[model samples]
Target: MTKEIAVLGAGSWGSVLASVLDENGSHVRLWSYNEKQVAQFNETHTNPKYIKNYTFSESITAYHDLAAAIDGVDYILFVVPTQVTRSVARQVAAILKDRNHSVNIIHASKGIEEKTYLRLSQVLSEEIDPENRQSISVLSGPSQAEDVVTHDITLVTVASDNQRAASEIQDLFMNNYFRVYTSDDVIGVEFGAALKNIIALGAGALYGLGYKDNAKAALMTRGLAEISRLGTSFGANPLTFIGLSGVGDIIVTATSTNSRNWRAGNELGRGESLEAVIKNMGMVIEGVATTRAAYELSKKRGVEMPITSAIYHVLYDGADIKETINQLMTREGRSEIG
Candidate 1:
């Protein structure tokens, strides 16, 4: 019942997932490009830089060598940030290219790449070998690394067109504290995962502006509306937006202190400049990139997404956050149905 899982990337999410898999009685090869972090994990059993205070399972083998980390692995779980997905995938492909390994890949990160505007799954398809792409699956939901590392009850959806692939991933990830559900709608699940980060930024801005609960509530509701509109426009099931990856993801990202996107928005709302906020966060706020991608997606698909447009302007054009808010609020009133 044991499997080898190569976890590429050593960020908070990667460390947390490695801990989860190790606890679930799997051999986890926790690969980090940073040798120092790998040494830290091996010595202390804790990813001191990311998920602090919790010790990882001893079953985790931290490795600095990419090929060694992936060797003999049956499954690859990518926990790298969205921006780095391609680079990591390419490195992994080069290592696994020659071998006719029947490995399944699961991607946990969410975000569309800005310049190419390609989804994470798309990036994987392009970077990984064609044989491996058929076995690719995406795991996404309202889950956070901080909560998962502490063994908080978290539910996530593992989606792939291949039912067997989903079932395999669900078995690998399911445990007492973590529940995995399977869905066939990969596009829907992925879109929900990527787009919710944008709404979270909006919610964080409201919180930072001292807005009351009513304002926050309204923002979240409308945020979902815009996100679903965009998702459905692109052949994603509208119902998926109501599930874990959509509404569930939106609530967690918008409200949780662990959300990097929300933190960035809060800083912006508190009158800090976008550059200053990003510099302080020291991490990729996926929503920032998603905003630009979503804006482009909306224009290309003829779907209206005012919220994403506002965020994009504030982030890219040096527009004042307050001015962006006023622009949104002052838009010509129309029927909610329209």
Candidate 2:
């Protein structure tokens, strides 16, 4: 039996998911904020804006109408960039409330809101009604849309407080090219998803400074340690940091050219100012905002995340890259294994 799934945003990640869901035999209604993307997808069955050169599956319907997209939807996938999640969620909630129907929401965006510092799941919970909150979940990992859309083998995790809902989502998205794992520790999943991007920026900065693999590996490993420590302080399972959403994600994002954050950091390392790098990317490099949020989160939680702090300083406080690297390297040495 096929399910009706509505995917918000028609960017690379959103389009990739629409293809994956349709390939799994679900009827997908993909909404695009860009009228051009919608027109292209509707007319040519191909999204030229993000995932070009690949046709949207015949089972996937592209839409520009919010209400029409949510009509009789079983599961709603919010794939919009992290910055716009709250706005999109508010719109969806209004539609759901007007229709007096609840839909299971799975957000694939990865970031902490800049001003509120709220995780994507928390943003949804606060914006959506209590009834809708019960069905919210998050899917995140090292999976990139460019790779996933090409049918590369990818592994990701789905997290929700409701185990049954997580399992249902797992069944809905898992395919030959993709594998989904389930977790009930929503905090660990969400924190790992957001914080890894900040660490990725730091790693990219290190690479931009002409650091070797050993230095990169050290930064990534220590970054994961601090992330786990901070997550554990927030009542999350520490072990999840060692899983796909944590260390696995950090490795991929920090090292891959496909990572916008990494690419942005590389430009910064090459002596470009933050403004120039962002203007060149032409999309929200989530880590820039996430670094600020994580810095605040660590201070609030009383957890020490040196790498996050360093990255935040470099990006926002005008800290020199060389000085930041020296500060990280000169920190009091600790035992290798935790």
TM-score of each: 0.97, 0.96
lDDT of 1 by residue, 101-178 (tens): 557888999898877878788898898987744488999999989999877999999999789989988998899999
Q: On a 0 to 1 TM-score scale, where does candidate 2 land against the true structure?
A: 0.96
- Flag regions of model 1 displaced more than 4 Å: none
| Weakest 10 consecutive residues of candidate 1 by summed lDDT | 94-103
Off by over 4 Å in 2: 132-134, 336-338
The Cα local distance difference test for each model comes to 0.87, 0.88
1-338: candidate 2 lDDT, tens digit per residue: 78999999888888898889988889999998877778878889987656668877777888999999989989999988888999999998898888888889899998889778787898998899977544989999989888998889999999998999999999999988899999998899988998888878877777888987998888888899988988888788988999999988998998998888888988888888999999999887889988888899889878888888988888898889898888877889888666
lDDT of 2 at 283: 80
Residue 126's C-alpha lDDT in candidate 2?
88
